[model samples]
Target: MKKIALLVLVLFCGTSNAQKKKKSTTNPIVAVIITKTENLTAEVIKPNFYIFRNENSIKKDTLLLKAFSSSITPTDCVIKKFVTKSTPLYYVSWTEKMNSETKLKKETIVVTNVQIWNPATKMQVFSNTQTSTNIKEQVFLDKNKTASETQERNRNEGYNFTLLPTGDFTLKNKAVESKYNLNTVTMKYELPQKSADVSKSSKKKKK
Candidate 1:
């Protein structure tokens, strides 16, 4: 009787260990939500969103046991456009406030940041903050503008980006027509900067 009991105990232990290992082997799935700044939504982001899953920025960066959600999720972002339909390219931009010394008082309106967020990596890849060269004449008015007025009027001059699968995209100052060129730009590279350590999952976005 004692010998029989020992054999059963060994087998039970082995089965338990196997089950634990299988649970750990399960892959992890993350949620990704890309926000579009109003006007660009129809042309840039919404048009080809299905392609995003194939993008290296979205695919290669994350691990998946499984993730499930709406095909795409939408969020609001504040972006001001200087020209409408002048160029076929679409872009999203965000700005930071800075106090500029003026004769009458201080002023604010310089966009110092633009970036894309990867839910899988929980990392915000930043754009070239040095977009001074690309700001087109009409994109943002610079001539004959006051300090405060110049800061507010000059939207396109501050920053711009082109979304690419590699995630290492920079824009040419010249405008070009491309479906993937729709990019997310922010005045701060860190979106939801407060949540540095949090890794987002599809469940969170659904909520």
Candidate 2:
């Protein structure tokens, strides 16, 4: 009797641990790389987005997500203008699988720093927030009246900011509230390098 009780207790503990592990979630981080910066305006050469645990998620709808940049990019684009639509410069996502037929589900979300870095100026802009929200999704198939699923999930997402044309942006959310601010201010004291001309001067001689 004593042996049977101990085994049951062990099994219970193991099951609880497994359940907790299954419920764990991971958040994605955001970033951008600006390859060009002329005057105050700039261009993003590449954007780097890092997502955690998105590979294992399942999706029933692509239009269910709402994500955007709290502020526009420092410069304007010819094809698409900023601030009109939810910007795609930042991304946060996670994946889930409901069944074998369900490949992978992705949610467009945000949970942390939204950053833009200009390597040319060595200037970086970032959001100051650690934000998260709970997501509940219920799907009902029109064709199959009885087919449906309800899912409750935690989504990580992020902050608001002010983009400065001078290669800087101000975060609307404070570090204390979001715990995403720096104790030490970011230094940008370096003066822009002056160009040197090796070619012959266009100016004619005084003679």
- Per residue, candidate 1 scores C-alpha lDDT tens digits across 1-207 of 999999999999999999999999996654334442332221123223211223433333221211223342323323322321122222234333444554534444343444343333444433444223222122234565533332223334533555454323444444532222223442222334333234355447779
List the candidate 1 regions with Cα displacement exceeding 4 Å. Answer: 1-93, 104-108, 130-159, 164-170, 174-207
Per-candidate TM vs. native?
0.24, 0.24
Candidates in order have lDDT scores of: 0.38, 0.35
Which lDDT value does model 1 have at 181?
26
| Candidate number of the best lDDT | 1
In candidate 1, what residue range of length 10 has the lowest lDDT sum? 42-51
Error of 2 at 17 (Å): 68
